[model samples]
Target: MVTIKDIAKELNLSYSTVSLALNASPMVSKTTMRRVKEAAREMGYKPNAMARALVLKRSGIIGIIVPDITNPFFSSVAFGAEQAAHKRGYNLLICNTEWNDELESHHLTLIVEKKIDGLLIASVNKKNHLLEGIIKQDLPLVFISSAYPSARCNFVGIDAEPGGYLVGKHLTDLGHREIAFVGGKFNSFSVQRRYAGFIKALADQKIAFNKEYTLSGEFSIESGYENGIKLLKKFPKVTATMAADDLIAVGMLKAMLERGIRVPQDFSIVGFDDIFIASLPGIELTTVFQEKKLMGELAMNILLDELNSGGDSKREKKSIVLSPRLVIRNTTAPPHSE
Candidate 1:
């Protein structure tokens, strides 16, 4: 029931001055701003978000779409984004697509309808038609963790190819000549880049890259378990393997253990994304450390910058790629000798 008009009347200030002070406009003196804010708070005044959005033409809300929030990696990224958004006086509208393309498209359409100021997506597909349309509409969009290769937009993530190379080099250095790669969807941008880096590392060491040793599936523990089983049956001679993400790595580890294979003694495993669950007491998985929270913060910050720029057509697109480091844990070690 409290309104800015009431606060302005109580403070004996003009409507415009009170409004500017409430907005924290630099034009208002800091002393006056503080006074107005204190009075407003004491009067139990609350902002009318709908009216404010109508006036400013912005919702002060950022939309984020991720494949799966259940996955610790994406959840961590979302947490970082939420913190960043809160610091800017903005709220987040999060959507989980469950790694489904249709759900992703549906969420995009629904979010645009909600009049969000900006969008961030860890997309399921490398290129989406609906996303292309959204880009042409000039909405501020940023890619987090995943990217659309054909779109000219802002993106923030780790340099995945090098991350894969690190795993490959680490395994090879430990005398793992017959290593395999088990990853997510083969078409996804992250998977492709990681696979490329793995191959490059093998070539550098003059180790033959065997297509038979590669397996691609969904970025889930279930999929990882399935592929892990397949890998064991098809090529039991392999000494080590790398997974696309921590979830997949954990899944693969389970399959190996269930089959009575001792980790690091029978086979070594490396994963991407040093998620929280990866560092558990028994499952200390070796993985590439992606600054998950940092990635989210950087992505949100980029979106804020673009929003502040007022949709400048001349503004250059941004691509922030962070470096990746390998975190050696209990899951990986030198190949075993009978």
Candidate 2:
């Protein structure tokens, strides 16, 4: 609880002189600055962040709002963001929405009320009006994963359609005709883009799209497990399945294994986002790799640039769309060759 007043008393200097010395003001002599710093360090004196923020109008804190922290994809993104924030001498406040719009709004309000320097949001829905309000306020906000094309805000996301197309093309090249798509809720742009790409690829190859083979639900392992069971029972002739994410693929894989269906022999699976567990000995998931860490780092850098620039110029909002790569593994093969 030591304050600048305590440091001034210990050094026999006035409070104004101590404040100028601690702040490295040009008026303070070098010798006085050194003595003040030494005394403050010795006494464990720390400036109040609230007072500093009030004076500067910036908390030096960035807020990140994501849909689900339990998902490994978001966790990786958070790690990269934290690393970049720390490197630039800033702190991060992460809020998990659990795909709830109300909670997301609450977190956004709190972050704005706290006067954070910037915001990094991965919204639950693409067309959220709440995000529009934030943009209208001229907040330094960056959208990740889900974004509206009409919004005049900075966004960093991947070309999900092309990535999904790649998955479908890979499967088709491997002679998978009866392909199924396991995706998250239909409202997500990521899911929709991936599905569109998959459908496009299939149509190009003269493979007819079947409604019975498609399934959608929450992007969770349990949802994947339940959907996998339903898809397998309903479409026993399905040869290949492209999952929207690694978690869904893993869940489906577990269900297939439990049902005594050998992967790549009975069914081929392709997943998106090459998570850490995707390459495990048992899983060996053949999937699309989205460079999530790089995305997070770039988002932070963009926010910092905007904050430092003081919103003076109308910088062209950047829409970075990273390309996804296909990681070949043991999970995918020519359908029913075994």
Candidate 3:
């Protein structure tokens, strides 16, 4: 509750002098600056960030929007952004959209109203018009884990196609000729790129790709469990599966376990986004590792660069794609010799 006026009164200094001293402006003598800081500490004075933002025209608070925080992958992304922002003397406001367009819009509106410094996001959908408004406002925006290519904005994401291709290569190398893909929504670019890569890898190995085996749904464990029934029934000949995410792979394991199908012996599985659960002692899911933290950190760095650019910051748009690596675990193995 202590304000600069209180410190000025105690120090018998002008309000402007106190303000400059508190900010460590070189205009104020170092001795005066030290005394003002001491007075501030003694009076328990705290700078009003909002008031500072008003005068400076920057909130020093970045906003982040993610589809689902419950997903470990998103959580990791948030962590990375928070750490990166904090290290740069900034704060974060995270909004969860729960995979709903309405919520995403509302959150974006709120960010604009609050005059947020910048935005980092893994948006709700591909056709997100919400970004256009933010851009028009001249607020810096960065995309993480997803990209809106048409917008020509800064983006940091993984090379999902290569990751998917790697998964396919791993499965094919293990003699998983009768294979299919499970999980992911129909329209997600991440899912499509991954699936495309998988198919490309399959074709490179001279293996046939079957479109019927690909299934679409929310990228959640429950969706994975529900789709397992249909996938198992329709693709009975499938000896292996490449799940769109670790959650799906884990859910598939749960469904198959209930059906008495042992993994790697009866069926092998591969997943993307090597979430923490994938490495649990019993799970040990074979999945691709995307640098979740790096995606967030780079996104924030790019946004800050733009924000600091003031008027002349219209640099060439940037698109950074982080690499994905295959992490072989307990779930994948060569098909059993018949």
Candidate 3, residues 1-338: lDDT per residue as tens digits?
A: 89988999999999999877765455778899899988988999878877877766778799999999999999999999999887555799999999888898899889988888889987557676776767766678888887876677788998899999999999999888988898578687788889999999999999988888888888899888877777788888898999999998888889888888888898999999999999999899999998987888889888876665552336677889888999999999988776
Ranking by lDDT: 1, 3, 2
lDDT of 2 by residue, 147-256 (tens): 77677778888889998999999999999888899998888888889999999999999999897888998888788889889988899888889999999999999999
Candidate achieving higher TM-score, 2 or 3: 3
| Candidate closest to the true structure, highest lDDT | 1
- RMSD of every prediction: 3.4, 5.8, 5.0
Worst 10 residues of 2 by lDDT: 307-316
TM-score sort, best first: 1, 3, 2
Q: Under the 3 Å rule for N, CA and C atoms, how many clashes does model 2 have?
A: 0
- Local distance difference test scores for all models: 0.87, 0.84, 0.85
TM-score of model 2 relative to the true fold? 0.84
Report the candidate with higher lDDT, 1 versus 3.
Answer: 1
lDDT of 1 at 15: 87
Off by over 4 Å in 1: 1-47
